[model samples]
Target: MSRLLLLSPLLLFLGLAYLLPLSGVMLQSVTTPEPGLQNYSAALGDPLVWSVIWRTLRVCLCVTVLAVVLAYPLTLLWLKGNTATRVLVELAIMIPFWLSVLSRAFGWLSLLSNRGLINSWLQSLGIIAEPLTMVRNEFGVVIGMMHFLIPFAVFPLASAMRSVDDRVILAARGMGASRMRIFWQIFVPMTKSGIVGAALLVFVFSLGFYIVPTLLGGGRSVMIAELIYLRIFQIPNWGLAAALSALLMVSIGAFLVALIKRAGVSTT
Candidate 1:
């Protein structure tokens, strides 16, 4: 009775703020246009809906891979770095989290625009007479997502890499193991839990992304979140909106379950 009382606040909050609203949306999916599975069936059967899902998955996977590849190297360097170097690297990794997402999106816009810094630098070097299209494309979307998610990958990876014993690495060095062998064999295996956890976090977050894809993508890359926004506001189709919301929730939950089972990693 005491334990239940202690948990009542959280339970009440979830019930009032989250569960109630979620239940309304779920109910709306079936009840809005004559209660049945028709909304889901129509959503699942649509080719355009499938295309959005595929794009979401692809961009998310790309961001996760890029973030992991980039962050893991920094994680390794951080592990080997002196205190000052570690502080600098930690600052670099964490500074993004302090900024607003909208601000970051606008910053990327300024950098990746045709007259932006990168293009100007390239043109000054006689690289190309014309500036390449960086913003309002799939590449731009991935870049935006990566900037935001890199910290997620790094923190988990840093925690995982710390679990690898320094003595084990030294032992491998003493045993004539090549640096490449040491990394592939000894270092990689030790950080599996962190990597998997980070990947799951990245992929799941990317699935629900709205602002980056909307702002950077310029409607060229329509993910589920953008689609939901359009359905609700532009078209005023509550049934379709609710259906997409429900589908997104189910898909994310399913992927999380499969990933946890495959990796045998616990979030706890």
Candidate 2:
């Protein structure tokens, strides 16, 4: 009872700061432009809206996959390394967190553009006659998003890997378990929670990403969040924007619930 009382303030703060704003946004989605289900109907009926949503999902999926693939090997290395080496690797990962997203996006643009560093070097080496179309497309978006998301995936996985006792692996080896068998039977299962958590985090973050996709993707790729922005700021269609925002929130919620269930089952 005392602990519950102590947490009441935090709970109240969340209710006021988080829940209230979210409810207001939801309400606005439904109530705006004469208080009907028209906005939701429009959202469902519009093919363009569906396309944007699908694109957002696709981008998020790609980013999550890339982040997880890269993170797994890095996490393993970090786990096996000495404390000083692990700290250095962690610091390298943390460097991106200090830089702004726009800066990083611009950095990617510099490297990926036709007249950029890669093209210049390749041209000088006579590797190709013309520059590659790397920036302002899906390729650039994926690359930029992966850069941002890899650290997110790595930290959780490394932490989870660290939590897994080294003794278990030694015991399995001592019992004559093959390397592949031990990894599949022990390490993979142990780190499932971290993988799921990292994937969820990356997916959620990428789903709503605006700057990376906008700068790198050009007009070829349109994410739901960007569409929502266009509706609100460009087209001034608040009702539709709110509806799209609500849909994005719902989708994110569903993914999070699924992740929680998977984590629960794994733990059980």
Candidate 3:
């Protein structure tokens, strides 16, 4: 009873700060510019909305796979290395988190855009006759997003890898298992929980990314988040914007529930 009383202020703060705004958005979704499910229906029926969703999903999926592949070796090095090496690896992974997303996106922009540093260097070497369009496309968006999301994947992966029993690995080796076999059959299976958690975290984070896709993609690779922004600010379609917001909330909620369930099962 005492603890409950002590937590009351926090609970009240959450209700006022989060729940109230969410409730308003949800209410506006159905009630704005005439009621019913028309806005939802319009969003679903519009081919352009579907295209944006598909692109978003595809880009996020690619980023998750790339991050996992790239981070796995680095994770192994971090776990197996000396103190100095581990510190160096950790610094490399974490330094990006301290920088703003906009800055990182712009940094990539300067390097990847046509006639940017990369293209100019290539041209000077006579490697290409024309500037390649790297920015304002899916390729640029994927690169920027993957760079930002790798740390999220690495930390979860490290946590999961740490929980793995080294004794099990030794036992597998004692049984004359090859290194490849041990890694594929034993170590990989044990770290499934971590991989799933990391992938989910990266994928969900990529889903709502606005700045990277906006700056790197140059309005060409318009993602769901950017589309939502355009609906509200550009087109002034409040009903559709509210409906899209509701959809994002529901989608993110579902993923969170799944992540929680996965964590629970792993613990048990």
Candidate 4:
């Protein structure tokens, strides 16, 4: 009873800070423009909304796959490295996180633009007669999102890999198992939880990403989160915006739950 009383303040704070704001958003989304289910109906009925939602899902899936593929070798290297090497690699992974997302998007914009660094170098080398259209497209969005998400994927996977017993790998190797076999049959299975968790985290983050898609992708790439922002702030369509926001939240929640279930099954 005493401990419960002591925890009340913390619980109250969480309720106020998190749940309250979420409830307010839900209320606003449902109640605005004369209330009822009109906003939700509009969100569902609009083909453009569905298209943006599908595009968001596709982008998130692509980002998750790219991040996992890139993070794996880096995680392996980090796990196998010495203390100093580990620190250096970890710092390199974290550098992007320290930078602002907007700044990183801008950096990508400069690199991927027609007259940007890559094009300038390519032109200097006579690689192409004209610059490539990398920026203001889905390509730039994926590249920038992967850049932001790789570190997130790496940390969780590396931490999980570190927890895996080195002796297990050695034992498998000693039992006539090749390195590739041991990695696939043993290491990959053990690290499945972390991989799923990281993928889920990256997907959720990418789903709602605005800066990378907005700055790097221009008008060509329209993500759901960006659409929601425009609806609420630019067009002042709070009802529709709120509905979209709610959908985003629901999508993330579903992903998280599925991930947790998979993790549980893998662990079992």
Best by lDDT: 1
Native-referenced Cα lDDT, model 2: 0.88
Q: Write the per-residue lDDT of candidate 3 for residues 82-158, one digit (tens) a residue.
A: 99999999888888978899899999999998879999999999999899988889999999999999988888889
Q: Which pairs of residues collide in model 4? A: none
Clashing pairs in 1: none
Candidate 1 overall Cα lDDT vs. reference?
A: 0.91
User: Which ten-residue region of model 2 has the weakest summed lDDT?
Assistant: 259-268
Alpha-carbon local distance difference test for all models: 0.91, 0.88, 0.90, 0.88
lDDT of 1 by residue, 1-268 (tens): 9999999999999999999999999999999889998999999999999999999989999999998888888887777789988888888877888898999999999999999989999999999999989999999999999999988888889899888889999999999999999999988998999899888878888888999999999778999898999999999989989999999998889989988999999757
Better of 2 and 3 by lDDT: 3
lDDT per residue, candidate 4, 125-222, as tens digits?
99998999998988889999999999999987987898899899889988999988998999999998788878877888888898889888878789
Better of 1 and 2 by TM-score: 1
> Which ten-residue region of model 4 has the weakest summed lDDT?
259-268
- TM-score per candidate, chains pooled: 0.94, 0.93, 0.91, 0.93
User: Against the true structure, whose TM-score is highest?
Assistant: 1
The superposed Cα distance between candidate 4 and the true structure at residue 40, in angstroms, equals 0.7
Off by over 4 Å in 4: 82-87, 265-268
